[model samples]
Target: MLTNRRSTMPMKHVRMPSWHAGSKTTTSALPTYTIDNTPKSLTPAILTSTTQSLPGYTTTRLIGAIHGTASLTHKVPKSFMKSLSGSFTGSWGEPKPLTQVLYQARDQAIERMTKDAIEKGANAVIGLQIRETEVMGCIVVSVSATACLVEKERRGVKRDSAQENPF
Candidate 1:
């Protein structure tokens, strides 16, 4: 016959090693990242496009060539990596996470380029070229443009409109 025994010793707090601790994990909810299209250093007066000249403006003087570059790595946010894995299996649609990262990088590059042009005393940027490249699991955006001074073209008044305007 065996007799049950009990100990009167008080229990001490014990800590267990957590596998989840120290390991980066991604949750189902995507990270909130706001992309600001407008930059403090850039303004609407500064025109940018992939063309030789601005439509309603004339390039008076070509200041110089200005370039801006920005890059984002795959590991920027661990959540993106996880989302990317699952994103590949979905139907044809926009990749919100990846697109947001790219847009952020592009916007930053554009802002930098415009700032550079503004420093050079250029009112507008023409022949703008934006290139996107992937390097070593990173997305790189490069923007180049010819900074120039542009003046708005004056539209000649028609004969009827001119006669209507009495000086």
Candidate 2:
């Protein structure tokens, strides 16, 4: 028969490794939201290009492929006011609310893709592609690119005859 008894030995605290520290779950405060007034083209810290390669920079290493996507919905209004404004603005007319929504979605997708590239230690994203799809009332935008490291190509200066013969 075993008797119920508490161990009198001192308890030792075990130190966890650095990698194991993040295994514990913790509650965090919700992030604060703010309006971003900066232009989308100027927002990314990493260089992005639609072409296979950057114009003036050479790829040092390819990190990997990354992707991002976003979706938004807007009801298209058929009203006399819109037609009147469209008529005054000529054949092309003013941008529709739907178009604006699509643009916002595209910007958000690209921003997310850029953030992914940054997190992966990439300095640039090449072969960037943005695809838009309209499903029901929602417009979804997807962005894809290859994250890579790039360096500017160094060009040797052309020496003129006068400079070469300078006394």
Candidate 3:
């Protein structure tokens, strides 16, 4: 014969899994949106590493200088505006702070440019310059680098070596 068993205590509630905590899920808070600064007539091309090796010549590569610029407009998101009356202290209808946004943009632009130069076989970058501008409620950033190729002379074997004989 079999006997039935019953519990006197109630069951506990289990919490549901959160998407934010999972690595498989993506978050909406991306750092910086890309705004192409390339001129309309100019097309940016990727320089391949194989191209760095010149035919019939050994060479050393170096970067001459790097230049960059960043510009941003403060849109004053609705969420930010809503918090202004509570936590933020400033002019009533003023836009977001330009300094902070521009700084972030500038840093990101510079990093991108440096990485690109490195990928193109550049050894070093010098004399960096940055510029920023705001136009029609949008930010524009520009960066440029000058690259150089150098070669070292190889030493030839001395003629006297031929006179020596090995036992």
List model 1 lDDT by residue over 87-160, tens digit each. 67758765556666666678789889999999999988888888999888888899999999998878993436
Q: What is the lDDT of residue 8 in candidate 2?
A: 56
Give the clash total for candidate 3: 6
TM-score quality measure for candidate 1: 0.64
Sort by TM-score, top down from the best: 1, 2, 3
TM-scores vs. true structure, each candidate: 0.64, 0.57, 0.40
Candidate 1 local Cα displacement, residue 124, angstroms: 0.4
**What is candidate 3's TM-score against the reference?**
0.40
Candidate 2: stretches off by over 4 Å: 1-43, 75-94, 157-167
What are the per-residue Cα lDDT tens digits for candidate 3 across 19-123?
Answer: 536533232222223355211222223331314344433335565554445566566555434534443465454323333345567666776766666666664
- Backbone clashes in model 3, listed as residue pairs: 68-130, 68-131, 69-131, 69-142, 70-131, 70-132
Best by lDDT: 1
On TM-score, the stronger of 1 and 3 is 1
Candidate 1, run of 10 with poorest lDDT = 36-45
Per-residue lDDT of candidate 2, residues 1-167 (tens digit): 23335865665546555679664434221112235522223356679888989987878899999999998655433452363356466567544433444566677898999999999999999999889887897878999999999999778955476766543
